[model samples]
Target: MIFPEGGGRESHRKEEIKQYYRSFLWSLVFTVPVFLIAMIFMYIPGIKHALDTKLVNMLSIGAILRWVLSTPVQFIVGRRFYTGSYKALRHGSANMDVLIALGTNAAYFYSVYSVLRAASSTDFESTDFFETSSMLISFILLGKYLEVLAKGKTSDAIAKLMNLTPGTAILLTLDDEGNVISEEEIDSRLIQRNDVIKIVPGAKAASDGFVIWGQSHVNESMITGEARPVAKRKGDTVIGGTVNENGVLHIKATRVGSESALSQIVRLVESAQMAKAPVQKFADRISKYFVPLVIILSISTWLAWFLAGKFHGYPDSWIPKSMDSFQLALQFGISVMVIACPCALGLATPTAVMVGTGVGASQGILIKGGQALESAHKVNCLVFDKTGTLTIGKPVVVNTRLLKNMVLRDFYELIAAAEVNSEHPLAKAIVEYAKKFREDEENPMWPEAQDFQSITGHGVKAIVRNKEVIVGNKSLMLEHNIPISIDAEEMLAETEGMAQTGILVSIDREVTGVLAISDPLKPGAHEVISILKSMKVRSIMVTGDNSGTANSIAKEVGIETVIAEAKPEQKAEKVKELQAAGYIVAMVGDGINDSPALVAADVGMAIGAGTDIAIEAADIVLMKSNLEDVITAIDLSRKTFSRIRLNYIWALGYNLLGIPIAGGVLFPGTGFRLPPWIAGAAMAASSVSVVVCSLLLKNYRRPKMLEHLDIGGIKIE
Candidate 1:
């Protein structure tokens, strides 16, 4: 298991990765000479003659050389395994550390016994296996070094996000009127909320806040995945870490430090990696008892082999002629212990999860945890909220027609004044549309409206320039007893039939004009829906809008299933109904009302939540709100889970097949035997292969959804 002890900071993890690599280097330095003396020099005729000659008074030169070389590797470089194994055993558990310490220590102690016997009797045949113990420690340390390196690559996304924040910021000293009077450069960590800062051209914003002084194009592609730099002006909110590309901007810090966008994203990704998935829990359970059970099997195999060797009188030549029954039994036991260690089983899930979550973060898809990544692969039904999810959330005035003989300037000024104070989307569209008409005038101003009242879901009414002005839909106009002529009514009906919102402007109880407003569908929305359909995913649109408007928008986007006029709670109920019918549902939405349905679905996907990294109910957040990311997310999850399955098969197969062979299963039939050094090499190779397999996910690319056309300047073909 990977331990994130320093709260997921990249520097802390780098230190840990380096520490393992350093330890591995030291182990190899000592183990190589020990290996040559114990395995190579003893087999060479000339070198064996020199080593067999007495160099010292009591000990042979070979015995003294092997002891000096192997002692440091067992006690110094291999000390962590002993301490880790002891701690785990004290807590009534056994892990990979326990298996390593047991296997290597057993081999080391047996070699020490052989060295002592050789010193006592000059003719005692030396059977020192110090090479087995030293090589086992060296191989395991090498596997650990590579594992640490692979794990670090999985957190590269978080590191890149932290690097986006500037080290220093230009803090501004403002006058009483909030105008900048002076500026000083200070560390970014010293910044607080409400502190005004200057962001010059090509500099990153210090914190999340609104632009207070200048205007510029800010590149938010790091968080939103949009390639274009967004236009930022005074009063426009800018996220911290976004760059001011072309203009100098003065911004006040609204959210600093932990509340910044970059900080939240890093925190969320770290938490996602640390949380265990359901399958991960199952793997943990199996590994918890896996080591101890392997120990028992190793002991059982040793006893069975020893009893068979004694009764059969060494009839099989599988046992070496020079070795006794006990030495042969010890060899098989050491092999079994080294081969059955559960390092690969421990690595099967987390390495894959870390790499998968990191890949999702780079694409602006924030998955909350491994459980979400696991569950996302099985989603077959997708439910989408209509307003901000399928169509552009902002409404625009499409066309306006005059219904009364009134001054055009006067009509625009009155409507703009009445609706300017309204916060509704349609009202804001109208206020923005009227501003363009006044560009020719030198100083065109809107008269302040009095006694203003906004009718929710209807429109606004106010007294503008001593005239009673009311701007609303047909229902609001009829509620106030305003008479509409046949021509105006026909115009309103025509716009509504085309899935547009009709706003009626009435001055002094007389209908003056009808404004056609519509929330247009987003670009490439139709193509994305078609792509999902071709991928065999069922798409459904759920909204509180009228059936006519909802169906009209759905039909244009190739969505056949429409749940129109459904309230927030009703949307969640619809999701539950689908889930009960044996379909895995993925709900996608952006508004607060969609939170309930987002939580009710199998996987809740929040769209366009660029700076809001902590979307409460969403399992996955698509920062750009692009429909293309929805397909990318599903494709990535499927591929990631598929990689995980392959890893499990390899890990389980390696242990099952390796343990028996190391226990001398083929000796009786094929006259073949496994060696302790070979067993250690196989164990190390198995763990390294599992980590290498997970690293392959870093190269995963989202499948091309629209291969025939260009979307966002990326040609899929």
Candidate 2:
């Protein structure tokens, strides 16, 4: 539900992290003293001479002290690995836990046997390895602690998202006429639909609803990534978690609890985080058999070394005179098992996905799922929906001419009344423009429209104030057999030439006036197309507008291809056609009609201001609603996948080299070998390096295309 106050499960995870830290500290405490009392410290040149003398008996004192210190570290601090290993074994699987348990226990049991022999006989040869077992456990614990810390940083975006909502709300008590009488603060969870809430200056909204009274500027940067605060008035919708900058507002809750926008965003981000990227699936497939394979290799290494040591007369001269073939074989096997870590392979992708998703959320780019990020990187062709996408959705009244016997105000009222119920961007613009010129003292009201119907890709039809009113394009007029006058045709041609959509308003089958509406190109639309050209990506404009207007708009934006008179289904067909032509297509749109096309594209990119249906169908949501973010989404995906590839190479290469070395491959030729402690250190380093590399993605920034260029005479001011 995107609760800002973390629930019980999150608290439990925090406790688990604390437990790991405590166990690591205890292991370090005992491991330090055990190392000081064993051969590791005794082998130091100065210490070796002193220990051999009467001051301390190397065998008796060191063996007893190391055994006493190592026991608790092995059993208490390293207990989880044993339990985890047992669980994995019962399930017929092998994992990092199995390696840790096998390597540490082998050295520990052998040391235990040696200590028992030393206590029984004075002639017992010293073979205690308490330091090796203790140090291995300590190192494994340290690695886990670092892993836990790194994983925490990767999820900071989720934490920040949850922090945006306030815990409490000020519920207002209203009188009979819906005027506020009093208010009481209560838990935000208690808020319900239809409840009235009071929001003051500097207070965040408690839920998603409509403001019924008062006015304010709301800062919605957290949700939309827009730096400017949007002004909110009565009847304006306000989203939860946005700050009210001035004045007070009485809002009627339309959506509360899990239905709020913040909750949906959290759900989308969490689902994306949980889903695996395509590259990650390959790594997972490899890891399913990686551990069991490593175990078999370790066994084979031991057998080979043991057979070689006996038949080939022990390759290395550094082995102690007291050690036999069996001891050397066991040591080599333990080193091989410890050095071949599957942890590095398993961690390679999830860490990168987590960091990438987190970074995306922070920038207001919500990747719907990891699969989208994987696919977005390969998009080579982009198809853009014209209205409310490449251009501003708000259509302004550029030029108006009245024809038949009617006042200008009456013509506007008839047109606005027919379009009042529609949710279209052009309809909204006309309604808003009409409201400003309304002469009524009270709230603006238009006569009711009867038999209303909205024609998809055309316009609206209705009977306003018992008079037939049709407001739409030339197609709607032609379909109804309403002939346009010579003067009207000339006006329409001039309007189309000027890149304006002419809304032809008629009354009772006769033309009344022509309202020239122009939805202007969005700032930076041209620059975005220019950048895509430089990037070698093809751009196409698909719209329901007439060819002349469509072509004019496309030319201004630098889009080379234009497909005019396209319905929603035709738009999807265009995307499919592009894919069939061997192009990886990306569809950018921002309306309900765009949902089908969005889903049809290889990568569906929905602008943040788009309808909920469009956003749901889209794989990637650009919160800025800026065309430039299309480039950002693609670039970010490419960079993230690049990092994943590098991680795979590093993990595979580390295992390829280390496993063979730890198996004693060089011993036959060079007589050199990696010790057990050194092998453990290398395994830890491999896992940590993969995680650190993924973390480096947090420093990513968008390309500086606009900052470096001086376009014509206009410097970026």
Using all chains and alpha carbons, the TM-scores for the candidates as numbered come to: 0.86, 0.90
Counting clashing residue pairs in each candidate, in order, gives 0, 0
User: Could you tell me which 10 consecutive residues in candidate 1 have the lowest summed lDDT?
Assistant: 1-10
Global lDDT scores for all candidate models: 0.83, 0.83
lDDT of 2: 0.83
lDDT (Cα) of model 1:
0.83
* Over 4 Å off, model 1: 1-8, 53-61, 117-126, 174-180, 313-316, 399-427, 430-493, 502-515, 609-614, 669-671, 707-709, 712-717
Reference-based lDDT, residue 453, model 1 = 99
Model 1 lDDT tens row, 1-717? 011322446667788888888888888888898888777898999999888777533457887787788889899989999999999999999998888888888888887887777677757775777888888888888888888887888888777777788889999999899876888999988899999999999999978999888989999978766667889988898988888899999888998888776777878888888777778887789888898898898888788888878897457666786577777888899899999888888788888888888899888888888989988989999999887788887888899899878777678889999998986566778888888878886445689999999875467999999999999877678889999889888887788689886678999999999988789897888888888888888999997665667788899999999987676788999999999999999999876668889999999999864224226689998887887889889988998889888888999999899988999878777877777878888888888899889989999877865555466566643
Model 1 clashing-pair count: 0
Cα shift from native, residue 26, model 1 (Å): 2.5
